[model samples]
Target: MSTTPTPAQEPAAQEPTTQERLAWMGRNSKKLILALVAMVIAAIVVTFSFSLFSSSSANPGNMVGTGTMAIENSKEGIAILTVDDMLPGDAATGTVEVTNVGDAAGDFQLASSDLVDTPATPPLSSVLNLVITDGATEVYNGPLASAGTIDLGTWQPDAKHTFTFTVTFAETAGNEYQDSQTTVDFTWDATQSTS
Candidate 1:
């Protein structure tokens, strides 16, 4: 007889009415609006960051590699010095010009490889002496096979430096060096001066 629930003792489980839901939303509206505003501001900042890095312009003044360094022989390009039937005490000479055609000054250095011989039985390079001169200054004077690097000093922009190289067969060479042919190559390097 007491099983029926009274209105005051009814269960509290009930869906929210439209008015209660609207009131709850209204209370939190400021927080929702602030979240949306923050998202929008972050998007704007990211867009501007991308734009700042995407656009590019070229300025010729800021370009590098506009400078040049080159070497030329008296023959206009690479030169060859041939000594046919070389005998003891015989010598040959050649010349080349190093120029800085760029707008920047540079320091120059020279290097030579050991003289290679066709008949390797007797290394003719061991019996050869080399002399290199820049105008009146002797930059290198040593054995052709053992010569290392030589510094030619600094060169100004648009300036040219002339070099003379002489190769001589040692006077002390004997008959064993006969018909032994040798060849040597020279390299010139340039680095831009900082000072």
Candidate 2:
């Protein structure tokens, strides 16, 4: 006789059908919808708060900038002629301390010329008709010798001479002297032949 067939094993319970799932969702739909709505509101609140903080950090109106401008290789003791407060003005004062730095005698002179239209509009040159005064005498006869011209008309090396200029707006005839900033941009001719 054939052995009794083993009891048929029931298949694993399958997932619920779509219709069954929909029926279940219909009963609990309100709670599910509320949960979804709450999540969306939380997401919107977090996004708005982050944006507000980011905007303040990126505001350019409250930013500050600090920059500087300068010149290089200028001769010693020579500085721009500026106003009393060091602001640009119509007049300036500059002083120069020249040294021979060469073996043979050096001959350098301060020759100033008037400048016409310029970047700062002031008619000025790197060179100025400096009214050099020694104690009380206006030394205008010879080139300022960072050295005293003793018997020979020459500058000795390793010697230091100082000259001061009280720059004024009244230059030579017909010079259209503008603001003081123009005097700051000047080139010096320190070409005394070095023997």
- On the 0 to 100 scale, the lDDT of residue 146 in model 2 is 23
Q: How much lDDT does each candidate structure score?
A: 0.80, 0.48
Tell me how far candidate 1 lies from the true structure as C-alpha RMSD in angstroms: 9.9
Model 1: what TM-score?
0.62
- lDDT of each residue in 1-195, candidate 2, tens digit only: 889989999999999999999999999999999999999999999999888766334545686764322112235444444454222233456665545555544555544444333444334443233355433445553322222322212455564555565654433423343333333333333334446
Query: Candidate 2, residue 118: CA error in Å?
Result: 4.7
Q: Residue 174 of candidate 2: its Cα lDDT?
A: 36
Query: Model 1, range 59-82, lDDT digits (tens) per residue?
Result: 766645565655433545364466
- List candidate 2 stretches off by more than 4 Å: 1-78, 84-91, 113-130, 133-153, 170-181, 184-195
Which portions of model 1 miss their true places by more than 4 Å?
1-77
